[model samples]
Target: MKEVYINRISKYLPNHPISNDEMEGKLGIINGRASKGRRIVLRNNQIKTRYYAIDDHGNITHNNAQLTKEAIVGLCDDDFKAEDIELLSCGTSSPDQILPSHAAMVHGFLKNGNIEINSPSGACCSGMNALKYGYLAVKAGQTKNAVCTGSERTSSWMMADTFEEELQYLQTLEDNPILAFNKDFLRWMLSDGAGAFLLESEPKGHLPLKIEWMEGYSYAHEVEACMYAGGDKLEDGFLKPWSEYPSDQWSKKSLFAMKQDVKLLGENILVKGVDSLKMALDKNNLKPEDIDYYLPHISSYYFKESLYKEMIAQGVEIPWENWFMNLSKVGNVGAGSIYIMLEELVHSGKLKKGDKILLSVPESARFAYAYALLTVC
Candidate 1:
């Protein structure tokens, strides 16, 4: 098989870091140390600080296209022109517009540079899926080089005002605001960033990650509607796209509102996520012991213990010390989390040549799981 190698990666984080204590005031929640819900979320997620693309006044500092452009710029070399990119894959959980695809907008930002553009928009797993698509294309000799990117402005999605308005409406109906909205839980969880990778068939003047295998799976039915953003739940228990729903419901805030079932998420992600990882490893005839390092994009530290226990049950004995994670610093950047985590590791100067790294990603909204293995060169 013709091997595909990821040559380099570029990551762009929008703004200054916001600590948990600062987030309490920024989010307008009273007495964070006293609120049981806030404390549990903080304790469970273990996120200390995260970056936001919005300003202190809750205005967007950068749009999706600008963030994507910055990440793409990082992928360029003085030797390689932007046009040399044969394939471009852009993945995101949030897009700037509904008409022109996010990838198309990125292409436009590059002076309308022409190249085959693929935009995979969905839950968090969309990033891994986009990377795999580009990798497979390069491996098949369809493209000499490809750029795979995952970017998110999730802070824009979980804005406090949106929930405040929703709460006001729910209160008018005499409904419990806390029960009607989950924004308070999510407001402190998701952040914003963009990351891109330059992939080629052969390495050039840089260490390339030789792709081993990549696969994706889903068990949506097992944990349906556990986490979701954008769209209205219907009478049939399905969600109607926000665009299809009445505009009045989103008059002030058109961005998608996220609703999550925290209990179900805790019960499902680790258990089902490991099962999917085992399947991927099995398909490649490899075992957990064969993996040298685990680069898991954990949504929170709450699952760290469960993940270890589950991996052990599945016969993989990799230790906690062998795992690479940045959730504590970056929080969860939606589809971009895995890409940023991978970039941090590559730039950290911690890996030796021939180290086998396994990357795992799980998406809550769509209940998707994905994994990829690579050998550092």
Candidate 2:
């Protein structure tokens, strides 16, 4: 019954621009492979480019908290005061410290704002999850204003020899050639970046987007499918071990897990995305033709395309051309992708008042999140 709106949004990338060609050069030399055989070159072609935080030594920087702070500062106008901020939530995988969440680090950076902050570790869904929490907080009258941020500095966790070791590990699995190639492809897709947004309960003058409703669906799948633990070892980064689970037992076990946790997440995401749009239409009772834009999670190139296809198959009319695709350029900024895209649309004047936008995010662990925002001029 309560309304939540996104008053402002902003995004930031590191100064270092790591192009595919540069990555290819590094890969070719490291794997002792010909330029043609190196998969990074090929996969990089599918993606636009990604930003990386680099240290003075030119190594990838892993300061997600710093990035989140920088992004928030950039989003806030000079007139905005930190004291006005009631909540600060960060959705991120890379924390400044293992014990202290990134939210604490971000809170310390604020000069005038004494706000309650929370750092969430929802893996890839963190950004969206944080946004949902902020929306609920405002809707429940617990806060008048809030900020949700999603940032990652995975490169900081990566070592120069890391790729080499992974490549070598794949070479050892010569018997599973397809699996090797898949692993190689993923290596190229991994990137580092951060994005953030500012949310207010009530619009001051005019705003581009207003949050109508949000819902989350989480399916607890096999722990090994996607697992990450912080440690000194390089292998502790993102791991997709779906193959490790037994095939015959996977679907059943995964389905069972989904029924209990993971499936509900996916179902919630799908239901929210579809139902929110339907509710908007039903309230006004407008046809599908009346809606204007849609922004789904830019997870991966293949994943994005597959999701669109699935939506279409489910009878959801989506504007394929209007869909903003940025993962190729920015890599996957985890929970930040949808909000970052939302900001881009507003700044670019593509999203207009009265237009309906559907936000969808389907992640690993059988998690799904969906929300609807109507531009209120």
lDDT of 2 by residue, 1-377 (tens): 46787777778787766676666443234455433434543453366676667644565444777788788887667677666778998887557676677888888776645688877676667887788788888888888878888877665444334445444455676633221332343345556666776777667644546877665555444222332322111244333343554664333222111111222333344444454445444555555555577677744464455555555665656767757656666766666677677777777766556777766665553343444556555
Worst 10 residues of 1 by lDDT: 27-36
lDDT of 2: 0.60
State the C-alpha lDDT per candidate. Answer: 0.79, 0.60
Quote the RMSD, in angstroms, for model 1.
2.8
* Model 1 lDDT per residue over 1-377, tens place: 47888988899998789988877555554212323466678888999888888778867788887788788888887787787888889888888877699888888887636799899878788888889889988999888988999888777665555556655665677644452435457766788889999889987655678988899898866656777766655556576777776777873333276777677687788888888887888899977777777988887898888889988887765787779899998888888998899899988888788999998988878578989999988
Give the CA lDDT, 0 to 100, for residue 106 in model 2. Answer: 81
Question: Residue 130 of model 1: what lDDT?
Answer: 85
* Reference-based TM-score of each model: 0.91, 0.75
